[model samples]
Target chain A: MKTWTIKLIVGGCFILALVVTVTSFFCNDDFWKVNAAQALTLILTICIAFWATQLKNDVRKKKEHAEQILKKIQAIVNNDGFYYVSAESDAIETQKRMTMTFRSLNNSIDLLKKYGQELGFKVNAEYIEKEFKDYRDFVSEHITDVDYLSRSESTLRKHSENIDNKCDIIIWGLY
Target chain B: MIVINISKDFTDTPGARYKSEGEYSGELFRETILIPKYVEAIASKSQLKVELDGGYGYATSFLEESFGGLAREYDIQEVLRTLVFESNDEPGLINEITEYIKMARRERK
Candidate 1:
């Protein structure tokens, strides 16, 4: 449940408990019965408030964990760090740069899937994996073309942005 | 298993397809290192395990030319059966090389 929703519930319970306690004092003719009713409502309110606090703490911890994982993914998908694969670029260096980053991204996606599944987050792991692989394959096939290289770089930037958006959805979905 | 560590046996920085392209070219590797070891494995009836780690990284052209050229020289199935890959650093390269090997045979036919 969302923090706001939990806050609302706690607020409502507090108000209800206050009203019950105040009314019981007014109904002095049935003193014992009113006291019993007031005690029950107060206990119930306290229980609900404690439960909400626990839930809110758990959500906060999970969000922090998700952010850490997303940061690692972002670093792997650092599009700006990619080597421009062109005629001038050394073939050995280009291959090294592409393969290392691509493999690291694959590993990150695997980690994301494992944690996302464990945490009940709906991660589009397959889509992310496909996007990374497609970009690598396109680079491999069109290494010498400046135009194609430019396009791949743009696509890579977009892919990185897409990953950010996806992570945002997962974080927001927690609410 | 007859092992061939490319990084150990040949250059760690393997380059493009043909020897004319540059040093440590896939063609050079196939001729100098891969083919001779493959021949020995065949004679001994053992698997040639090509360890594709400890290297900088491989170009698609390098992988395709080396393994695909091997498939071209030998029966495709025989090459596939005789050669096993150990590429823990980049496991995906194994599949990529396998596809290139298969495609090279198809192109030959």
Candidate 2:
């Protein structure tokens, strides 16, 4: 439940307890009024206790979800994410890898948007997007450089690593 | 608008950057599919919309070569103005293509 909703529940209970206690004092016998006030206080205390537990659970779940997204971003940075595949000779395999990578990156952006906005953090997607574009461009530019493939591959790997660092900066800011 | 559905008109399984790389290459797309439609659109004074969804995925080379190569042949500004790209599957693709077109000449030089 939303923080506001929980707060509203607490507020409503407080109002109810105050009205009941005040009315009992004025309208009931001293012994009955005292017992009624005590009972109402106990009920209010239990409600608050439940509300606190629920709030803690909500915070924990949000943290875990953030961590899950962080792990995915880490995988992309490590160049070993499920979608991050080596460029293969087979066009079909290559296409599959590329498609998945694109989708994965896009999904990361979406996840960051949701979590960051909810958590009141700034999300800058430009850096990651540019880094990915650079990596892809490097691969395409040097795909046929057979004589210097190793050097080009290293440069490509560096670009991928750069993406990882950028993610840390952007996504870590959320925390 | 003149619409070119890449997945339908051309091979959905697009390959690498150059023709020498293999079948369904970016060079092939540019020379065969993209350029012809572009020319027709130009002649008709209509904007060409290149739909880039429904494909497995595109290599950077394929994307760069196809759109960037077009910019190389025509004025980059004209190419940018005349062509519109739609990639619902990958929203970033439009920006990537735009960058490729913008940098085509510098890279070529």
Candidate 1 residue-wise lDDT at B40: 98
A47-144: candidate 1 lDDT, tens digit per residue: 99999999989867876776677677766666566634454566556656765676676656666666677577644655665666666655545443
Report the number of the highest-TM-score candidate: 2
State interface RMSD in Å for all models.
Answer: 3.5, 3.4
Query: Candidate 2: lDDT over CA atoms?
Result: 0.73
Q: How close to the true structure is residue A2 of candidate 2, measured as C-alpha lDDT?
A: 91
Candidate 2 chain A weakest lDDT stretch, 10 residues: A80-89
Models 1 onward score TM values of: 0.61, 0.63
Top candidate (DockQ)? 2
lDDT of 2 by residue, A1-175 (tens): 6989999999999999899989987887773534778999989999999999999888768856866776786686576432233443443554566556756766676676576666654334555556666765565554444333344556656766776676666556644
The 10-residue segment with the lowest total lDDT in model 1 chain A: A139-148
What lDDT score is found at residue A139 in candidate 2? 51
Per-prediction DockQ, in order?
A: 0.21, 0.35
